[model samples]
Target: MKQKSIYLIRHGETDYNRQGIVQGSGVDSDLNAMGQAQAQAFYQAYQHIPFAKVYTSKLRRTMQSVQFFIDAGIAHESYEGLNEISWGVREGKMPNSFDNEYYRTLIENWAAGHTDYPTDQGESPEQVANRQKPVIDLILSRPDENPILVCMHGRAIRILLSWLMNEKLATMDLYEHSNLCLYKLIYSYETKEFTIEVSNDSTHLLALVMHQ
Candidate 1:
């Protein structure tokens, strides 16, 4: 059976990431210096692939990360469904002692298989999955010949992949993702099944890091 392929890329580091601040969906922050370099590295690495379409989250970081691909003449589109989970009340807070305790507790719960538990003003894993699934189904329904490149946030990508694999949401906590990491996915047309061909592949970034 012929398979449809999708390349999922996590957006590069952002100013919030560098500053250890909570960004969530409250603000659309752009990429930091390291992020720009990472995006460029990704572009150079995947330039040979003939992607049929490219998708990016509405956030500035994800959009900026994929801009290189568009500049290289690749067809692309932006989707708000690809945006990160909202952190609500904690959006612009710095990771200080006051917030650190709350943040640690939230992260621990999430990592400990609590998909339904979310921060006081944040999105639950289930809620995020609910919002993202429809967008993914739309992508899946496209013609098999169309290879897609998806640029999105870390949490959203994790939720989408876990849903595709029918894995528990908590399993996402086990996977470590780096900025600008790329994952390859293959979907079986006949059986309607999907498999991950690559997860968090950053050899391209590593090589660039070494060169620097």
Candidate 2:
């Protein structure tokens, strides 16, 4: 069975993240100063991996997070499918009491198996999964890209992990994430299964941990 390693990570923090405002796929924001430092730390830790290619969402934050590798001449690709889940009307807005309650209810609904439920005019987990299917299939089919680095958004990463492991979408929240955290996975072609080597690993950020 041919196997490949996939290094998956979420983009670093943005002003929206630090300010506790929602920034979904629609809000194209860049990484902040702290976010840039976190990205540099991650690149320093994994620079020896010799990644075959770098993949990121169309969002700038994801691309900026992995800019070092891309600038090093590593092949790169971007996909809209990898973008963050759209929070619809809630995007770019700080969560007020009502927004908080709505978010709580939305998450509870998702956990209760209402996977198709979406925020007001937003995309559902099922919708996001459907969009991601083609991108994932393309990644798996590329034999030349043996070991790839992918940077995406938090909600999208959670959805992708759940889909890859064949877990219920309702359990997506079980996959925790932070800025620039990594999830290393191995995919076996013969078994057509993915084995998670690491999950939500942030050891590379030990230096930044003390300050942030």
Candidate 3:
């Protein structure tokens, strides 16, 4: 049985991340300086591996994170399905306070697997999975023997991982991913199953983080 491999990576940190903002699909911020360096490190770390395909979200942050691969001559594609869940009414606004009751309630609900509840016009967890599943399916169906790199947002990544693993969305809380963190998954074409080989790896970024 031939196994297919995929590398899922969250995009580098954005200015909003530094500001403690909750950005969603509606936000299209670019990578901050540290984020750019992290992306570079990711590229350097994986330069020796020959990737068959590279996919990225339409958002600037994700696009920027994978730009290093492009600069190194890797061909890649972009997809809107890879975009983060739309934050809707809360797109650009910072919460009134860290403990804002309403905002905290929404996050808590999302983390608890309330997939259908939308927070301030944002797409629910189910909605995010709906969009991400198709892209993942497409990747799994590819016939290529080489690995594929998927560049996307944190929320979308979590949703996709949940769907792929047949786990509840709330399980995402157990995984703490940082900027440009990489996860490797192996897909079995015969059984349509995927096994996670690694999660949230940032050996490439350690030096960069220390330099900051």
Can you give the lDDT of residue 127 in candidate 2?
A: 97
* lDDT scores in order: 0.84, 0.94, 0.83
How many angstroms is residue 173 displaced in model 3 relative to the true structure, after the best TM-score fit?
1.7
Predicted candidate 3 versus true structure: per-residue lDDT over 1-212, tens digit per residue: 97888888999988899887878898889899888888889988997888887899888899899897887777888888899888788777776865388767877897877878886777888888888878777777676746878898887887788878888887766666878998999988888888899998888898987887
lDDT of 1 at 79: 72
Of 1 and 3, which scores higher on TM-score?
Answer: 3
Model 2 lDDT at residue 126: 95
Can you tell me which runs of candidate 1 are displaced by over 4 Å?
A: none
TM-score of 2: 0.98
* lDDT of candidate 2 over 6-96, digit per residue (tens): 9999999899999999999989999999899989999999999999999999999999999999988999999999999999999988899
Worst 10 residues of 1 by lDDT: 139-148
Model 3 — TM-score against the truth?
Answer: 0.94
TM-score of each: 0.92, 0.98, 0.94
Candidate 1: what lDDT? 0.84
Q: Rank the candidates by lDDT, best first.
A: 2, 1, 3
